[model samples]
Target: MPTAYRLLLPLGLALLSACAHQPGSLAVHQQSQCPLSLRSGQQVILTLPSNPTTGFRWVLRDGASSLLDSLGPEVYSNPEDAGLIGSAGQSTWRFQARQAGAGHLLLTYQRPWETEVAPAKTFDCPLRVQ
Candidate 1:
């Protein structure tokens, strides 16, 4: 093989090998991505539309604790460039696949004080880890 071809072949193979072995994080934005399939040690990121200024918040009812581990509490971020009060934002939660199992990651959006009332919105996603 030519000198340049020999050098390029190993570099290309190295990159392909790295990608094949790396477990990438899975991002879930809506219910359409339900029945998530993840590998052990892979990160799972869940983001949902939220507007906490309206007194509604997404509460974690089930986090698939047996199959995944929570990385941290929910994170809320608003678009600073919007420059408007009570603007809609997003809430994000992170988790890591722990073991081979299946469960549901469920959340309800509603006012915490109104226990008697039903949730305004619900997000329930089934998760499978291997």
Candidate 2:
């Protein structure tokens, strides 16, 4: 093998390794990435599209409390450039993998007062911590 080829091979491997998931945290944005695999003590950040101005709120149904612990309450943030009122934003929740187990993180988007109405949307993701 050429000397330059040998040198570049190691550099390529290093870059590939850096692209893997980080050790201490993982960010999830969509349900397609569900059935998450996490290491113990790793942080899980979940963000979903939301707009409370429409009278719909993301309510936590199952938080996977058996294997994960909530780090804080839901946080909502709107884009700074979208100066208009009632614009869509995002809702984020933070959690930490506490033990080796499997569970599901579930949430529904619905109006709090509309008990008779079904949720407009739902987010359910399976989680595995090891």
Candidate 3:
């Protein structure tokens, strides 16, 4: 069915986007539209794009503290990690309305075996949930 194909398209694309890379050097050449906004009490899906197999992690942060961590769409085995980018070299994280405040997406990429955390970027995704 057309609807089923449409739904499966994203998943197929995600799998095709995965690429193995050296750890600690996972870098995003660029970032597209990020930090999507959603209404309070409403649920929405936000997709974070990344380079294939970059080991991207999606971290939801509420101010100074973290709310949750997720493993996105093309994460493979090998190195043990909590979060992995799904197929399509991107991960989709869900969001819900919370306390009418601001939240942030903290994306980090560091080399293997080192905690230096190089080439890290933070995106301000604001939602005035009311």
Best by lDDT: 1
Which should have the higher TM-score, number 1 or number 2? 1
The parts of candidate 2 lying over 4 Å away from their true place are: 1-22
Question: Candidate 3 residues 1-130, lDDT tens each?
Answer: 6999999999887777653321121222234443444443454445555443554554444431223223343242332353553444444554444445555544444334445565455545433333
Model 3 deviation from native, Cα RMSD in Å: 14.0
**How well does candidate 1 score on lDDT at residue 89?**
96
By TM-score, the best candidate is 1
Order the candidate numbers by TM-score, best to worst. Answer: 1, 2, 3
Candidate 2: tens digits of C-alpha lDDT, residues 25-50: 79999999998999998999999999
Q: Quote each prediction's TM-score.
A: 0.83, 0.81, 0.41
> How far off is model 1, as Cα RMSD?
4.7
lDDT of 1 by residue, 58-122 (tens): 99999999888999999999989979999999999999999998899999999999999999999
Local lDDT at 43 for model 1: 95
In order, candidate lDDTs are 0.95, 0.93, 0.44
